[model samples]
Target: MSNIDIRHAHSLPPEQARQAVQDVADKLADRFGMVTGWSGNTLNFSRSGVDGHINVAPSELHVTAKLGFLLSTMKGPIEAEIRRVLDERFT
Candidate 1:
């Protein structure tokens, strides 16, 4: 399995940070057919070949994911998109 881990610092307050995380979750769900649910500050998500969570903290957002064999080959582009989205929302 291949992994993706990304972190971004955010200046927003907790509530707004969470809202920002949710916004990203919503986009992921819409674009990738990912099913997402929140457990406290961590949002869990899963779909074929992909599984991960978005963690919302006071000062930053962290995303961790594992990609299956076939998807693993696409890691570079996937990480790029994830970073792009995180940067767009958090920074």
Candidate 2:
């Protein structure tokens, strides 16, 4: 999938990054089949009925994290899936 821009930003210290990322994860959880679970250094979001995973990582001193997803070979219309979830949930 291609990159989609999201508006909104604010300065946040390193320690707050985890909470910020968690907020996004919480919203994503509302989407159908979007199960959110966290591990030590990453937050995992499963989507497309468990066919893919969106990996979220929050870096220090940044207001936003770099979010990435692993698309399944069987997954079709990957970008639309991501956009729908992000627009309805993250934005």
Q: For model 2, give the 10-residue run with minimal summed lDDT.
A: 58-67
TM-score between candidate 2 and the true structure: 0.42
lDDT of 1 by residue, 1-91 (tens): 9999988888899999998888888988999899999999999999999999989888888899999999999999999998888777777
Q: Please name the candidate that would achieve the greatest TM-score relative to the true structure.
A: 1
lDDT values, one for every candidate: 0.90, 0.46
| Model 2 stretches astray by more than 4 angstroms | 1-11, 49-91
In model 2, the clashing pairs are: none
Clashing pairs in 1: none
Cα deviation at 2, candidate 1, in Å, is 0.2
What digit string (tens of lDDT, one per residue) describes model 2 on residues 26-48? 76676454677766645666555
TM-score of each: 0.94, 0.42
